[model samples]
Target chain A: MKIIYTSFIGFVFLIVCSSIIISDLKGPESLILGSWDEVSWEYERVNSTENSNLPLDNLVKKEICSNMFIHEAETWVFKKNNRLQLVKRGHEEEELIYNLRGRGNILEMIHKDNGTEIYQIQDLTKNKLVLHFNFDLQVKGIVKMTFSKVD
Target chain B: MLRKFNNYRTHQDNLKIAILTACSAGMVNVLSVILFFAFTSNVTGHYAILAQEVAKGNWYQAAIVFIWISLFLIGNFTSNMLIIHSKPGKSTYLAHATPLILEIICLLTVSIYLQRFYLNTLWETEFLVALMLFAMGLQNGLTASITNFSIKTTHLTGLTTDLGLLFSMFTKKKYRKDKKLRRKAQILLSVVTAYMFGGISAGILHIKVGYAAFYIVCVLLGIILFYDYSVLKIKRRKRSLFTRKNILFSKKTL
Candidate 1:
């Protein structure tokens, strides 16, 4: 009886595991893959005394849209080839290729330059995208972007 | 009459254990896959694809997942039933080998089907999905064998409910015999924890590396196979030695 019971469990376990793998391989690709125009991104100073103080000079240097645009960027590419490369003018020639993967709609991208850099994309749509980043300095941030298709 | 009732009770116990182990095993593999590779247990999760499929009168994909799940259940049932009838040693060997056998069969079936339907546009690119289902079936089949029927790793519905009941028991009068219950709780907790870990790990790994999850499952299956084969070989050797001695004695007497 005990042996019977154990075999039964093994069968169930395999089924669930396989289903999960199926989802990752076959489910709807997350909507974050489309192009996006920079709207807003927040960069927190790791050593700042006043956590809320936004460096005015840093904010003004970029093309800030109504106190928006966290980082200076005209366009960003969320590719299907496991690369999320940002096309920014000043940063490294290409934002260190962040390895991207997903199961269904949930997408996670890890910056290969530093494995500690994690980005999550959620609540994605044709017109809107939410980018959540967990940086290496233990600082967390969000970027809310709204897009208009450029024909 | 009492003996009959006791027999029924034992049967009930065995059934309960079987169900528990199967569920826990499923949960464990789901969680492990998610933990190790960002894979998801449910294809749609909260998505209404089933409803959409139903509305569109295209229930084939949804039915496929269901059928996959059913095969897994059937595999579990067969393994359990076999163990119930086999001699103790033979049962042990069957318990471990059945899942391996099922996986091979499933893979062959999927490959054959894909070959036949390769030209069909409406067939849908679901070969991967089929493989996933087969893998899940194998995983649960094996897990059911390893941890006994005390754990259910696939769906947490029963395990979570049982945990709630146990917690309520904590508030009631303490029984010295509750020690067994406590041990049961610990095992359930560990399996549940492993399951959650699997989910997180699969999620992260799938995010980082895609399709590698299948290789991981293959590795796990291989380990179990090696262990079972070794045991079977040892048992066969022991039996052969005993038979040889018996034959030698008969020849000496003749």
Candidate 2:
């Protein structure tokens, strides 16, 4: 009886494992691969913008060149040979290279210049992409992000 | 020397039992994540992308999958309680039987609804989630119950951490390793590995076959039921045969 039970379990295990293998091999579109571009971004405050009491319309037109890099650029790139190289001319010198693997349309990338930091592509679409990056503010580390896409 | 050797053998047997428990528990957690990933990423995640529908405030549709999550929680709660309370040997059949019946009814209901009335869009998603929750609950509950508290198949957050502890203890080599602890580690690992593999497989299936994953669950439950019944029938036959032989022997003696 014990032997029977053991064999029965083994049989079930084999069946389940085989099913997974077959499904994994069954398709191509299941692989998320392609070029994606940034459309818009949502940013976290670097410091109290208390210095500026600008109105909403003026704020939209305001592009302050403060030393603090509060905004991040959203960029998309195509991938081949397991590596994704972004085509943005200025950002090319930047460590922001994307790699495609695992599941879905997810991409993993690293900022080369700032080797200390990492970013996760939280969400993406044909027109829009969302990126999350972490930084230290005060004593604690915090996450902030930008959403962007090509018009 | 011989007496001492026998003691060593029992200790070894106990070790195997512990290992199996730890493995099974780990498998449960991995599989749960895998199932969730597969369902959301491949099978049904697309529904959420219907922004137009969402903008219309289709609460019914939005709430459908969540309700399934709720049902699954209910199933787990029930099964966990039942397993914890019931005598180990007596509860195995019940563990497998209850979910099997519930799943079948759910499936039939879905098919009928599709064939007969136009189900509200919200109702359709809710129904699917409910079916999934109930089925998963049964699967996890029965597996957990049969194995006792030693193996949990539905979730793994606890198992992986426990395995880490056991690994450290093994490394320290300070105190005499407890045989009971060793048995637990084995069970936890087996369950954990199996469930993780199951989830990966289910994820792949979700991509290729859609909700047919539920059908597979149904089949596995059926297999479990058949196995339990067959074992019971054999036990009954053996008992009846023993009784007949005893009666004949008494007649001859008389």
Candidate 3:
């Protein structure tokens, strides 16, 4: 009787671990490739006191601090072969090559001139994507960018 | 249980550590998967991912994976080095407890950082992941060294392989009847079962509590450390009492 109960539990556990592995194996590329509208963006300072004096801080304050870059009809298109298309409201579309790398939740994107952008993929679902990236200010800080899929 | 080291450890001691450490490893690994989408307790999957990156000419990704694997190795090295270099005539429990204390500190740091200021940025996530991998390395090292490599709790690949070999051998009456082999089988079963239970529990808890689930793992390690410390204290008290009685008897004889 004890052996039966124990085996039953083990069998159930095997199923759970197997399911996680299968889900992970599905890959994040498909989930990230579609068009997404930028919903919101914010920066988090790691050392707010020390980095408040940096030039990037002033630039971010003037541009992205109070006013979000939520242009009407803005869409980001991630394509195959490491290509990215950024379309802003009433502006010419910019095409850039990008490489999406890393496994699991830690993802890194390398752009042609932007060097390497590291992002923590907080959540990636069928319709929602949340990303976190950091800037190396004098004291280091992060930016949280959220996007919703555009149909 | 606390004083015994290396060859002097009994089957019961091995079993106790196996169950406790495996459950802890399971919880840590599962929580990491849910929170960071990575495996911090083991490097088996990372090695495969590293190879895949290398094959695709993704040097940056490959380098990250390589560094992660190296951290796990360093963790193991640190734990064993502590165990190997204790001053003679000192309580070995201190040496054994040192690695676990370090593990607790690592987990505690991770828990506090995530709770207060986790921005979910890549560097922050990677930093947390590295700390977790190192903590697990320390744990894996301590358990493996103390048990004479008879038990490893951090990864299931080797455990599953050993289980397969044991079950196949058990089909024969000769292998099943051997006391040592049977004991080994029992130990393996306990470790594997406890590990599964831990993972299942973490899966449920992480959903409800989010990153706070890591604190529970810290508490679990604390329990193990406290248990060992209590046992050491009792052992010391008994030794002192025995010495006092011996001294009184010798004076009377004089």
Residue A58 shift from truth in candidate 1, angstroms: 8.8
Q: Alpha carbon lDDT of residue B104, candidate 2?
A: 52
Top DockQ prediction, candidate number: 1
Clashing pairs in 3: none
Worst 10 residues of 2 chain B by lDDT: B1-10
Residue B60 lDDT, candidate 3, scale 0-100: 41
lDDT at residue A89 of model 3 (Cα atoms) = 76
Q: Which interface RMSD does candidate 3 score?
A: 11.2
> After aligning candidate 3 to the native by TM-score, how far in Å is the CA of A135 from where it should be?
31
Q: Which stretches in model 1 have alpha-carbon errors above 4 Å?
A: A1-35, A40-70, A78-100, A104-119, A123-143, B1-96, B101-134, B141-150, B154-157, B167-175, B178-183, B189-223, B250-254
- Which lDDT tens digits does candidate 2 get at residues B1-254? 00111133353432332333223323322223332221311223334433433464433222333344445655666655654565656644564465546645554454345446623232243344455456556555544544444444555667688888888888765522777777667667765665566566656665676545545544544554565577678978999999999999999999
Expressed as tens digits, the lDDT of each residue in B163-201 for candidate 1 is 888877877667425876776676667656656665555
What is the C-alpha RMSD, rounded to one decimal, of candidate 2? 16.1
Q: Which scores higher on DockQ, 1 or 3?
A: 1
lDDT score for candidate 1 against the true structure: 0.47
Which whole-number lDDT from 0 to 100 does residue A132 have in model 1?
Answer: 50
Q: Score the docking of each candidate (DockQ).
A: 0.07, 0.03, 0.05
Grade the docking of candidate 2.
incorrect
